[model samples]
Each structure stands twice: as structure tokens, then as C-alpha cells.
Target: MASIKLNNVTKSYGHGAKALQVIHGVTSAIADHEFIVIVGPSGCGKSTLLRMVAGLEEITGGEISIGGRVVNALEPAERDIAMVFQNYALYPHMSVFDNMAYGLKIKKVPAEEIKQRVAKAAGILELGKYLERKPRELSGGQRQRVAMGRAIVRQPQVFLFDEPLSNLDAKLRVQTRLEIQKLHRELGITSLFVTHDQVEAMTLAQRMIVMNAGRMEQFGTPEEVYNRPATTFVASFMGSPPMNLLRHAPNADFGGKPGAILGIRPEHLQIGATGWAVQVDTLEMLGAERLVYCRMGDEFLIVRTDESLSSAPDIGATIHVAPRHDRLHWFDAETGKRLP
Candidate 1:
């Protein structure tokens, strides 16, 4: 496996009036055998950054290196990396065995060696029994595994996953995500994954890069991004239901406020005996816990509450939504930059 590095890489489309920079000057290093997740919103350039590394998109400036060798001039096939696309991209008519063996065949690996490698990958992906079936016959999850298996058989220097689980159902996504994690652990290959899903980023990455508007917003561990976000955008975008910055803002949503945004996660907001009194707009019971969407000042916020509370508030019920003082976060009112 190889360590990947990008130096001041950029990508811009067209000239002058029609020009738009899609990838800013981004520089980072992904170490050997590290599982790095690149996450951002739609149009945030996460995929573009990944495609650049995969040699599918050219870098406008600077260099990209794999295994200490500059590969900016190399073709996709010459990069020594296997990419797993968002769509399974398996051949419709080919059997799973044939699909898995295609790349090795292209490289002219011996037939016995190809069979050995494909069998090993199929066994690891739990697809050994489906070798004779075509892609259409498999479930979404199974098809995704086959796509991954195709990558595994190549035994390249790196594995690139471009949101490979996005096509599966919610339940299947979770299961496949776990399998991918386990597979990564077992294989220990340098892998870079791209996804817009924050949960996927949080769960799969050893280190994650959060991108915004083609720029690097933050690059750190999942805890570092979620707990101590470098910018307000990172704060609001990284959590489930997100942190409630409204409670800390005197006038939150409409501007002219003290800060551009105040940030806190849903889990940080709790029902307390004393705090800002709120009007409950809705109460959503989500099995083990409840979500209390309440009005704090002029802004609405979501708080996680215990399901066994003695008295659950009515839709219009007044209650107190308090934040854990130690876990609070603040940002500049106008710039949306995190306050120190």
C-alpha cells in the first residue's frame, strides 16, 4: 500500500466570465494503510478531490503522488489504484467470477493466480457462493460487495471508494458499511472514501477531511470535527439534527445577531429544571429516546430527551431547554467563523 499526497491542488473550469473554481488549493497527506473519508455537502468538491487522486480528473495546479512517486502525468490505468464507483458498475452479462477476474485478465495475470485471488476476495466478501450468478440476480448489497470484490482481486496499492454504499437501502447501508470497515481492517490497504453522509464519515474514517465550496474546511479525526469544529459550517453540517446554536443566540435566524451562529448538537440539549423556557413545537418519539423540537428565543431547536420522563410536554407545551455549559460552541455573528 502507498501513502498519497496532494500539494496545493486546484481545478477550475473555463476562462473569465464562464470560469468557476471547483477545487481550491488543497494540500494534504493520506498515510499508508489509513482509512480517510472525504466528506462535504453536494457541490462541495469532495468527489472531485477524490477523482483527482484516482487520476480520473486532472489537477489544475500542483502535484499528486502515490507511494512517493509523482503520478500527475499518469493515466488512470497507470496509477496502480482500484476505484469502486458509486454505481456497482459490474458487467451485466458477465458472471460474478468473470467480473472479478476482468482487471487481472487485462493485466495478463496467470489463470491459476487470478482464480486464487478472486476466490480469496470472494470468500472475504462472502460472495464465494454466488460466483456463477450475474449482477442482475444479486441484491443491492450483494452487488456492492461484488464491486468491492472486483477491487480486492486486483490487490493494488490503494482502494478508492466513491460512496459505494449510497445505492443500498437504509438497513442494508448500515450492514454493508460495517462489512466494509471489517474488510478494511483485515486488508489494511490505504483507502480513501468519498461521501456526503456525515454518519458514514464518522463511522468509517480514522481521519476525515471536511470540504466546503471546493476548499478544505477542516482535516482531523471524527471527534475533532464534531466536538471542536473549526468553522460554523462544520458545526451545523456534521451532526444528526445538528447542534442547537439558537438557544445561545438572542436573535439567531434573521441576522443582526451577536454571532452568525451558535452551535450545539441535539445530544447537548437537555430538559432541565432551570434555563431558557421553550415552547414545544413537536415531540417525536424515536424508540429509545424522544426528540423535542422547541422554540428557544426566536429560533427553533431540537433536543434529545429521555423517553421515560415523568411528564412529556404537549405540542404547545412550555419547557426549558438547557445546554451543558462545558459543551457549548460559538461562532462569529457575521463571518460564521468559530469564536475562540
Candidate 2:
């Protein structure tokens, strides 16, 4: 395993005045054997950043180093990294065994060693029974495993995954996620996974990089990013129901600070008698929880409540809800940055 470093890494399409800059001075140090996920919305440059590290996309400025060696000019193959793409790039005609063994064979590894490597990878991925099966004969999950197994046998210093689970069904995605966690635990290879799914990032990443438009909004553990976001963009982007950003708060005190946007998570709002009176717009029952959509003056607010705690209120009914004092987050109204 190897540590990766990005020092002010940047990317641009054209040159001079018409240049279109995508990545903007991204800098981070990925420790050895760390599983870091790059997550963001579409067109946010998360994939572009990963591609730059994989040597697939050239950096416009700054430096990329792998295991203490500068690799700005290195080719993908020379970087000693394995990539698992969203589409399982498997050969239709080749069996799983041949597919896994192809890389070692091309490197002219001994035939016996190739068999051992392929067998070990197949065992890890539970593909031993499907070794002789062709790509057409395998399920989507199985094919993806084969692709991962192919990478595992190479024993690269780094592993790059570009939305490897996007094509799978929801259930399969969950299953494959578990398998990947297991794989990382057993092998402990340094991995960089790029995904647009925040749930995946939160579940799979030891550390996550949240990107927006081409700049990195935040980089931290899932808990840090979720609990104390650095900016309004992260506050709104990383959550499922998302943080409620109120430009005009219902209260006058404004959480003891003035002239800033207020942020409150849906779950933090409590139905009370002495607070903001809001009209219920809608209610959605989601198994154990309920999302109460309400309109407070001109601003919309969503309150997440446990179903066992309270019954749902009728739509169009006015209700009072108070935000937890300690849970209130303040951000600059103009800059959208978090305030102390």
C-alpha cells in the first residue's frame, strides 16, 4: 500500500483566455491503506479529480505523488494502480479465471504463480465456483466482482473506483458495498472511490471529500461532515433530507446572532407550543420516521419526527415548532460560510 498526495492539483480544458478550469487547487494527503471517497453531485469534478490521480487526466498545475514519487508525467500503467470502472470492463469470451489471470500473464509471471494469484483473488471475492463461467453467464454483481478480482490480483499500490456500484440494483449495491468493506479490511489497500451518492460515501469512506462545481467544499470523516459542516453548500448537500437553510428565521433573536443564515437539521426541530407557527404543507411516512413539510411564513421547513413519538398532524393545520438552541448553525448570508 502507498500514500497519495495532491498539492494544489488543477485541471483545465483549453489554454489562455478561453481556458475552462475544472479543478481548482485541490490539495490533500491520503494516508497509506486509507479508504478515501470523493463524493459530489454530477459535473462537480469529483470524477475528474480521481482521474487525475489515476493518470487518466493530466493535471494543469501542481503535483501528484504516489509513495513519495512524483508521477505528473507517469502513464496509468506505470503508476502501479488498479481501476474498477462503473461498467465491468470484462472480456465476453474469457472465463473468470482467464480474466483475472490476464494481467499477470501479460507481465509474464510464472504460470503456477498466476494460478495461485487468481485462486486467491477468486476466493476472496467468492468467485471460485464461477471461475470457468464467461462474463455473459455471470450476474451484474458477479461481473463487477470479477472486475474487482482482476484488480486485486495485480496487487497495485492504489485502487481507484469510479462509481463501481451505480449499475447494480439497490439490494445488490448494498451487498456489494459489504463485500467491498470486507475486501478493504482483508487487503488494506489504499483506495480512492468516486461517487455521486452521499449515502455510499458516508457508509464506505473513512474520509470523504465533498466537492461542488469544481472546488472541494469539505474533506473530513462522515461524522464531521454531517455534524459540523464547513459551509452552507456542505450543510445542504451531505444529508438525505438536507439541512434547512433559513434566510429569514421565524424568531426575532435569531439564535443570539444577527445577519446570517440559520441552519437546522430536520430531526432537530420539535413540535412545541411556544415557537414558530407553521402551516403543515404535507407529511410523508417513511417506516419508523415521518417527514413533516411545513411553511413558516415564506420559507419552507421540514421536521423529521419519530413515528412512535407523535402522531401526524393534518395538512393545512397550523403548528408550532422550535429548533434546539444548541443545534442551531449559523452561516454568512453573503458568503455562505459557517460562522463561529
Candidate that would win on lDDT: 2
Residue 275 shift from truth in candidate 1, angstroms: 0.5
The clash tally of candidate 2 reads: 0
Q: In TM-score terms, which candidate is top?
A: 2
Q: Which parts of model 1 have CA positions greater than 4 angstroms off?
A: 247-260
Put down candidate 2 lDDT per residue, 10-75, tens digits, no spaces.
999999999999999999999999999999999999999999999999999999999999999999
Instruction: Give model 2's TM-score versus the native structure.
Output: 0.98
lDDT of 1 by residue, 212-252 (tens): 99999999999999899988788888998777765355533
Query: What is the alpha-carbon lDDT for the whole of candidate 1?
Result: 0.89
Looking at model 2, residue 160 earns an lDDT score of 98
Q: Whole-model Cα lDDT per candidate? A: 0.89, 0.95
